[model samples]
Target: MKAMVYRGPYKIRVEEKPEPIIEHPNDAIVKVTLAAICGSDLHLYHGMMPDTRVGMTFGHEFIGVVERVGPSVQNLQPGDRVMVPFNVYCGSCYFCARGLYANCHNVNPNATAVGGIYGYSYTCGGYDGGQAEYVRVPFADVGPARIPDWMSDEDAVLLTDAMSTGYFGAQLGDIVEGDTVVVFGAGPVGLYAARSAWLMGAGRVIVVDHLEYRLEKARTWAFAETRNFAEYDDIVVELKRSTGHLGADVAIDAVGAEADGNFLQHVTAAKLKLQGGSPIALNWAIDGVRKGGTISVMGAYGPIFSAVKFGDAMNKGLTLRMNQCPVKRQWPRLFEHIRNGYLSPSEIVTHRFPLEHIAEGYHTFSAKLDGCIKTLIVP
Candidate 1:
């Protein structure tokens, strides 16, 4: 079998590897039909994440047909088309019972992490990922959601992770009817945040990003108002001005890094108070929120850590939540949404390349060429 293997940072290669077989009583073997690269994969590419081991496959978002199932796996059987949630969790755990599958006791025995990410790193469990010809889906009965008869494989692929993350961010942001929400970054996740916010009945959704292609793409096709981060002299002021001086009801930091601004002034904002330009995205989110509103974040982090202005956050009575996303909890809801035809996540896919041209697909996607947001690898 052929698989895309991670040799090291910035060194992913397509190589021949043995096919996967069931190793657990609850495991199932899936013949991958569709798999998409995720932003989280970038962490592995950049060597920013510590858990990514060499020679491992590195993708989590995919939909496939069951080639075989473990004897204990009864809910899903041969020929069943399904999407694998990014996490590999047992449904009976304490966290799973409370709908916090990310922190599942059965999945994350290390207790250092909350959720299991496919091909991410050993930190999350060194599970093989879906960026291959076949994948061994552990705990399939609990983690796999059935793809609908009406949806295509490409459309159902994102229900595994990216869409679920966006939905989680929106749910945390408290998107309600008539509320205005601002989302930072127009990447795949951010665009989905805008979409999810709209589905939750938000009155207005604003997507912010510096990339002209992404900004235009979000506005034109995704149905969200957009702002170019590069054009805004001050995003917070711009958003407030746009929202009639009251700011937005909820602001989401879909961009993990801080943008340029008055960060030095409030250097001591927390204990350091760094103020003026504290990562414009978070600042914009903090400032954009209306009084007593929420600020949600879905961007991956830890490469660079900054001092947060807890006092400022507290002053506005803001609520903050950030994570790798509790995909297990959102899988069923996202599946229902897809079945009902409310959100089509596959629209973000701009380029497709055969498995033989995997290298080329990586180049185009990494460069963000010609409105490319998400790229899929076909085997």
Candidate 2:
């Protein structure tokens, strides 16, 4: 099998590797058909995440055909086409029973925070991810779901992470009808969050980003107003002015570790590795939302100290909600939305790469070249 192995920061290559086999009674070996390079994957590529070992594959959003299933995997068979969520978990755990699959206590040894995530890092349970020809899925019965007959492979792959997380961000906002929502970052998650906000009855949606291409996508695909944070002297003040000086009813941070705009923050967090992630986007969310409004954080950050505005949040009485999204929890409604033609997840796909050229794919995406919004890898 050929897998993308991480050698060091900004270094990855497709190398021949041993094929995965069923390792547990509940495991399944999946032959990956489609996989995506998520925005969060860049964290690993750039050495932002801790304990991302060399030779580890980095991918989480993938869909595949079951090559083999263990005896205990009763819900699926060898030939089933399935979409696996990013989180690896045991369904019967206390957190799983409460629909908090991302925080399942029985999976990761370091269950003090996030649960097992495919291909994230040692911190999230050193599970090999589906960035290759084959991947071993643990707790197969709980995580892998058969792809709906009506869904396309591209759409199914996105549901594994990006779309699901975006919808979860909107769900966390608890948007009231006619509320104004501003989303920071125009990546896949931010675009989906902006689009989902409309479905949740937000009167207005605004997407903020530095790139013109992504802002254009926000306007056309999400049907929302767009703002380039680079254009403004102070984005929070600009947001407040746009929202009639009271600020938006809700604000979401979809840009995490590599957020630009604040020079010192980006340098200290991304370059110096001083904090978990840059607090620019999260701080913008706090400042852009109204005093009593909500702030939803869907961005990926490391498990370390970050200089966040806890004092301001408390002073303004803001409801700050954040977590690694429970991907499977959003599947039911997403399936319905896709079936009804309300969303075509494949539309966001801007590029595709073969497994052999995954390095090129990573370079293109990391550099934000070719107007790349989303890039898929066909194994």
Candidate 3:
């Protein structure tokens, strides 16, 4: 089997690896048909995520065909097409029973904050991911759903993580009718968040980013107002100005560890490893949303202290909601949205790379080169 193995920060290579096998009674071995390099994968790629051991693969979004299944896996069998959610969890856990699959208690002995995630750092559970030719799926019946015959393979892959997470971000905002929403970062998640806001009855949506290409994507693909943070001396002030001085009713932080607005913060968190992650974008969300409004955090941050402005949030009485998305929970609504022609997840795919050229794929996405919005890995 060929897999993308991490060498170190900014380094990865395709190498031969042993094929996976059914490890648990409920496990299934999936032959990956399509996989994606999510922005969160960049945290591991750049060494922002901790416990990301060398030789560990890094991918959490994928769809595949069930090559084989354990005796207990009755929901699926050989040749069944499936889209696996990023979370690995037992469906009967306390949290899972409450619809919090991302916080399942039965997986990931490393931490209690997040459940098992494929190919993410060991901090999320040292599970090998689906970035290779085949992957072992644990608790397979609880996480994977059969890909609908009408859904394209591309859409199925995105629904596993990127699209689901984005929609979850908007759902956390609790947007009301005619409310204004501001989304920071124009990455795939941010673009989807902006688009999902409309479905939640937001009257206006604004997307912020430093790159021209991504901001352009915000305008065209997301159908939202765009602002290049690089153009404004104070983007928070600009956001307030654009929202008629009251600030946006809700704000979503989609740019996580490597946000690039404050020079010192970026250096301290991203370059120096002093903070959990750069709080530039999250701080912007705190400052840009109206007082007493809601702030939804979709960005991935390490489990460490960050110099966040907690006092202001307390004084403003803002509702702060955040968590790793329960990816499977969002699929039913997303399926309907896709079938109704409200979204075409594959349109954001800007590049594709074969399994052998995944190293180049990572470089392209990490550097934001070639107007790349999303990159897919074909095994």
Residue 118 in candidate 2 has what lDDT?
Answer: 98
Best by lDDT: 2
- Alpha carbon deviation, residue 225, candidate 1 (Å): 1.6
Cα lDDT, all candidates:
0.78, 0.93, 0.91
TM for candidate 3 is 0.98
lDDT of 2 by residue, 1-379 (tens): 9999999889999999999988899999999999999999998998878888999998999999999989988999988999999999999999999999999999999999999999998889999888999999999999999999989999999999999999999999999999999999999999999999999999999999999999999999999999998899999999999999999999989998768635665565557766556777988998899999999998998844656788999999999999999999999999999999998888999999999999999999999999999999999
**Candidate 1: residue 349 lDDT (0-100):** 85
Candidate 3 — which residues are off by over 4 angstroms?
A: 261-274
**Reference-based lDDT, residue 292, model 1:** 87
Tens-place lDDT per residue, model 1, 108-132, is 5564655676777777788888888
TM-score of each: 0.89, 0.98, 0.98
- Model 1 gets an lDDT of 0.78
- Candidate 2 has its poorest 10 consecutive residues by lDDT at 261-270
Of 1 and 3, the candidate ranking higher by lDDT = 3
- Tens digit per residue, CA lDDT, model 3, 1-379: 9999999889899999999887789999999999999999998898878788999987899999999999999899999999999999999989999999999999989646888999998889998888899999999888999999999999999999999999999999999999999999899999999999999999999999988999998999999999998898999999999988989999999998868645665566567766656787888999999999999998998854657888988888899999999999999999999999999999999999998999999999999999999999999
Error of 1 at 341 (Å): 3.2
lDDT ranking from best to worst?
A: 2, 3, 1
